[model samples]
Target: MIVSKRIAAVAAAVGLAVTGLAGTAAAAPAASTDLRLIAFNDFHGNLQPPAGSSGRVVLSNGTTVDAGGAAYLATHIAQLRGQVKNSLVLSGGDNIGASPLTSALFHDEPTIDFLNQVGVSASVIGNHELDEGYQELLRMQFGGCHPTDGCQFEKPFRGAKFPFVASNITFDNGLPAALPVTIKFVDNVPVAIIGVTLHDLPSVVTPEAIKGLKFGDEVQALNKTSRLLDLAGIRTQVVLMHQGDSTEGGGPDDCRTLPGPARDIATRASASIDVFLTGHSHQQYNCVVTDPAGNPRPLIQGASFGRLLSVVDLKINKRTGDVDRSATVAHNEVVTRTVTPDPTVQALVDKAVTLSGPIANRQVGTITADLTRTASPAGETPLGDVIADAQLAGTQGNQAVIAMTNPGGIRTDLVYATSPAGEGNGVVTYGEAFAVQPFSNIMQTITLTGAQLKNTLEQQWQASGTKFLQISSSLHYSWSQSATQGNRVSNITVNGTPVDPAGAYRVSVNNFLAAGGDGFAELKNGTNLAGGPVDLDAFTAYLTAHPNLAPPASDRVTVLP
Candidate 1:
């Protein structure tokens, strides 16, 4: 049997036998085959090494190491695959959407090419996959030029060589949106891989993007798929689910406790499923959760942005056509940059950088200090405040008095350090700004009564979680922590004047929020919908208009204890 040195060491440390199955009563399993699964998630088209904390992975010993980049990831996967004769590369999800300027500028076609070269066998559909809508996702899988932009790269857009699967997402006719399962024969044993996204997908994506889609319960879908695969004699099942949960700070392999949707699903899913690989929360964990039939299976998630890889080693019984649950070993391995990166993938990244350089490197403005999405006690962020102000300014022609933007839309911070582009310190490039707000959601203005505006603020505290809206400087309000959900927000004012519940107010927001994305349904009730410039244009214009932009104060929202 093939086993990497690291996996051997891990098995030894855990008192488990890697070879000959020492723990088992019977040792002679001549019909067994060793299979390795290498997985990563939330890549988000990071062709280049991500900068700052996003590119680092925390190790079991508490030290952080630089990790991730398409080339480096390729090298790591190759090394892992070489350790086993039979192996498959897989993805949990979020492989593309919300990408860096190098990839996003070209509509993330570069990322597809990178994945195609890496030989990803299959991947689940992440919610970000729906950012451009389902039709665009189909294009990503089927190979075609973008409908609006045509072929932007040198080669015609050749879509993903792998399947994009999601068992839970369906169209109006109740047909699956993508392939539900992909079967891989390992040593002649059929292993079924099932993919599903979070059932609460519609809440996160723009309403229009998922207008005709239906998201079913994850556990039910996984169980149903497992049953069907079982009937087809495919007993070895693996899940690539896009939904995940978080832990309070732990190493890549540490699983002191597994709490979240993933745990709940693993606990409820069919025992026929041998392993679970997850993504979307962007947290690293290597856990063993018990299935419905009380069999322990590996449940792992690598930290996002390719910083870590989830490795699962399985011993499938060729005679029984199922995995030996007790023999499975899984861990999260950091994709450190110490190794030699794959030169071919590096060339792809360099080509993309060269193609996108002129537009991406143009100086947009300057930031005196870092404008980040780090929320204060009151849930306001400096970058969020600036984005709201930018949207407000972009719609000033429509007389928008207040502007609000979702916190989730702010992808990254605007750091003041010199980037790889060698731009001067504090000099913000168009590329930097694009990474901060990559969605390109359009700016929209609507008319709402003061009472409706307050209701919109209350919508921030939803059943899912609090999603505080970054407000323009002209709008101010105080929310109480002690009060009930719908009644928590009060002390509303606009431009130093007390808001009159009966007074009509003009508010600005991105098209996503205006359409009630992120659970802010009150925004949908607003009347007189007026469209403005694309949000990215508004932000870059605001940056160019204001040369030395200072980080906005987070004193807009008052939090009462």
Candidate 2:
């Protein structure tokens, strides 16, 4: 009844109803009304418009203007709730974290406030939640770290209003208690939402972050929780899972289709589950999967960064409150920027903007040249070079001798441009730099033999275009792509000519990659490690000390012609 009326409204505004060609007319309402549910996932702190242009979201009647901010999401949630008393709001996971500096700097406090205002009832735990470890998560759920602490700025972080669920994650022997597993009975519907985090949480997050926790099987977790919910007479069951499948769209920022573990688990889920909402991989889709009983269960995920809103309309038998045997409909709606902002939600957005004003407006410095850190022909970029250089510089007199950076660790491209009016100010903001390298990776200095260094270079063969290894001053190596994997590096040098295989060499790298992360096997076996502080700050200090210098473009770590 709501959708039909909505289409009628669209038709009335666009004159589609005048022609009666706006698709099938809504079937007359059955004895029981329809329940509208909304879900979003992987909103990684992109509160701004993901795209440059704004387009009208053609909602029923006179196209209610809407868009992607948490404010707009709140507006949408409010409007939907107005339509159906039984409406539910939920997330697949990764609602924040891995976001722009505006939110990340505050440990994603603004995000929790926005979610609270948007009426999020439940969510799964995403990998990014571990960015600051479980302690920060507690802060997000409760309040800011301290009113006088650096975590607090213009305003204190408003805590989460809803529950965060993660069923399969277990704490360590002496660690603190984790969040609860499931939620039940929203609006007296006897609804049950079971949460499950990704099994590969350790691989994605820093090992130290998950040091005291263990992530268990998603399917098993859901099954156990479902049985518990069923025994409690809760028939309406949904899974809020954080693990995700990939999309055809390349790059971490793009959202495409959904497949992989999320879909597989949904298709094989216990019959008790009516639907599954997924995240983690940042893909988007509305797929209907059949359970073992051949019953169609809906699998859904909204694209990342609040770019889309997934809506599932289900018909429940009034008496049993069970989804009607043949009445489930699913679709994803893009959150276009044209939607009018709901005043209340806009108020929340304004507060966040005001809170972030000082730091958001500050300019840090400028990239003297185009500092890039993506996979390159020389196996490294200016950005990678900058990061490595900073690490070595930070530990100059400390226990560090050489610093190494992982090729994959570099996330964004850095380009410099003059300020408008042709001013010499080509400054980069702390926010901009963070965007270029979002991961809060800690630096480590390891004592490695030259033989081990050669082996580390050889590991690049395991992943093509992974030869990116930036150094502080002088480190040179050449490899032929055609050579045998282990024998690729031919001319290995540090500071000048060939390096002595038996000589000890101090090298720098982030803790993750040094621990054989991303399958870089040689890094794990390296010797004598030191350091646990954020590498970006070190880089900032280096830049502050030398403001006018630019790293020379060298073909040191090169692919032999």
Candidate 3:
């Protein structure tokens, strides 16, 4: 189901490569005029085989196929590089952390080791890399002091294989050196790749994880850095960006239509960038986008967690030393599940699976009913509501009148549990729930006026697809999208009747959204009356206390006319 749109231009006379079909292999010219590049993003540490069905990915042509896994990806990469004299492999960030039990349990050490074996040239540091403390990120990148926590059976942590790239993030005083902005050459091509995580990390991530960091403007940072790289004579450029768009499809191979942050920024960027490898939204796409400069630039992103591989083949003109005007080629290889797991990657995973045998098999807790995360009728989700409720309950305050949770914070979908069961052989395990909410987020309580609360609701539509506020208890309002943006919320109520617009309210939420992250402007404006308690700890406590807790059906928060 992998979709591709090939734009082959020979001196302004353009011919579209046949859609839904692979392009015929171009004959290799002697002393080849073309150089090649391969890129991927948002891997999120899915080292084992994917969750469900396994089958070959079929191209539009009737011929059958096989794809994916680090080894298969390695094989494809090796084959592609063999065809061209110069080649580069790069990532769009989030290559590690917020992953499955196989990788997450060990804090992504195995994932890093695998990347080392794969010869990944460079990578952008995705937001999840900062899911643990920033110091944890340093530990993953460089060596660190350690005492064996329950992981005594496993091998000691080995640090990163390659340096992580982050041009816009800077540490406060007393912090270590920041990651380099650009990588110079792979086979002496002078290729420059700018790495940028989302600018809203402080609000999008658990506050404890990103407390001492600052996320700068991605567009501004890239623009200045691209200028610097251009001035230094680096012609070939790519942005390994973690921001992504949404998509509609049943499985991995479905084509994407709505572009996310990558599209908006790519469309407005300078002419220096030639390609964009994006992630974060877990969508699949292969298409060419034009920057503000009006030049067509190529881009690709696979579905999350090794579900697919986006193989972008670029032919750099030998004479111009840039993207070949005449022979540019691009397509994606969906990593179907059915293929025999690549022996090498499988071997590596098998080794990790053996080492993690005890933890992987242990059970944590169970749900009495389905804990689905799909958006609700009011654009808020019950999963989000449950998460917010846990955060509120975790905070020991008497006057916690309200709460909020970001949709992005809920990382997995939970099915209803038939009964509470024992460890390793029960309904759900500690490993499973931890995988669902892996980030170390802390619950936060902030005070805001009912007026500010109204503004927060209004901001949801200021931009489409923003996470609507999922309330912990009863907070009522109505909106009509047919009307104005922020003015949509009406019939404001807290317990039952109506909430006074000027009255003060104490609200609980994660640290991420409270800091104006993800474009929720009102959250940034709320008064930090007080903040305390780890959100993750609260979530763990809730699960431990209510092993058979059913999702509440009383939908208190709503969007109305």
Candidate 4:
């Protein structure tokens, strides 16, 4: 243990070795320099116990355990905090937006309230933070009534006490919108944490949400921020990054096969960064990657929905103010149900549930079976088909004959069994539908030539190697794994008519797709655009119109050998 503690003296916040002129042995390390960093990410306003698979964690032992809830998280956090005197709790963002019914109903006030109550120092701005747009995000930071919705809570809604930092986001004028670094003192030691979202924010977020804001290069931003912090004499630096990598077929805590933007960033960024707390991929990993200078840096992501918590022990050297990287150790801990739920957090949750219950619990429609998000090899999911159809229906007034949606937009599986929201088996509710398509994206109809539609589909496999789009019943096509990328999509038809290069057709898509979000730049080529209802409204209307919605056969897209 002494040896482990001795290594905490990394280049940042680390005290130099106090050796005599005669080369005396090093003295005992100071206990006051130890700083406990408790971190989590991608919370997404899951104030209640997350439903179904969202609330479960699979341990390295291969056993699945139920986890998460604000109450239990509060208990776990307080207990962990109690064990250490000098500590700072942090998050990697997505703390709000894409939220469940309980928090989203009031515009995620409860999420901010929870964070403030728990003493979260700061968080980076995630893609979801812009879900409602920049002005809305500002409102979240500095409280007021919704421009349209007014205040939903009983009392006036005061905003977050913690600061939001996004090192890479800047105004069109090149001025930073958020502070690049936040400094906190623990035992008179200043620890600087730099925060930034992924570099590819424009690709994943709606164009409307990021209208005039520009996301700067992440590596450049971090390097500049670290240098500034170093100049300011705050060398014990960490990065709260809202981007991550996934290890295929690896356990939650496995890092042996790491490959993703997070790893790539660690490989490119300056070695002065001691650790990275990442999110967005929603995959859990606790691994150390070598930085550009060959120094080891810890990169961790606690899985989404409060299911996991990352606890890190960092010791700084008093005199040098550098991290004892040698003494740093981190691990992802499961927020197991064995821990007692904090009554205070539960009370807050109970009040939120009480206010949100009526609308969330009321049944909207019935389903014959689960409309799972699991896609076939051809990229067709039952839930996706239903969502596509809903968008088509919503845009029919605008002459939309077919619709498509991004697979990543679908958040969860629509189960046939009774849900945690207390609805009956096979019954769907407003809250469930909202949870399925929570981004509040408006449906849009646009005119696209047959060739343009073809280009959009092919573009999916071009830039990023394929993020398949879910198609409406009016559209049908087949692709083969053996064929070349451009030649893969074939037998394309709309309403049983073969696509003609010169023919124009009305296409239905969410505003995100309309703006070429997700790398489908061809979408931006569509002309004669017309706006339609919000996506959730369209989906709820579909459920209301078809009282007994059945899962589409999952046969829309064919995968051939």
- lDDT score for residue 304 of model 3: 65
Question: Against the true structure, whose lDDT is highest?
Answer: 1
Show model 1 residue runs off by greater than 4 Å. Answer: 1-29, 59-63, 256-259
Where's the lowest-lDDT run of ten residues in candidate 2?
14-23
lDDT of 3 by residue, 108-130 (tens): 77788777776676788888888
Q: What lDDT does the true structure give each of the candidates?
A: 0.87, 0.66, 0.65, 0.82
Q: For residues 1-561, what per-residue lDDT tens digits would candidate 4 score against the true structure?
A: 121222233322322111111111237645447788888899999988786677788777777898998889988989888887676788899999889888999999988889888878788899988888899899888898888888886357788877788889888998777777766765556677788898889899877678899998889988987776666566688899998876654456777445567888877988888888889888888898888888887888888989988888888876677887878899888887788898888888898988998998877788898888777878888999999998898888999989999888888777777876567898998888888888888888999998899889887784433688999999998888898877788888999999998999999988899999899899999999999999889988898899778888877788889
TM-score per model over all chains: 0.92, 0.74, 0.78, 0.91
lDDT of 2 by residue, 483-540 (tens): 7768888788777867899998878788778877756668888777777467767766
Ranking by TM-score: 1, 4, 3, 2
- Cα deviation at 363, candidate 2, in Å, is 2.6
Which numbered prediction scores highest in TM-score against the true structure? 1
Query: Where in model 2 is the C-alpha error above 4 Å?
Result: 1-33, 49-68, 76-85, 144-158, 173-181, 184-188, 250-259, 324-326, 368-386, 392-403, 406-426, 438-440, 450-503, 515-522, 541-561
Worst 10 residues of 1 by lDDT: 14-23
- What would the TM-score be for candidate 2 when compared with the true structure? 0.74
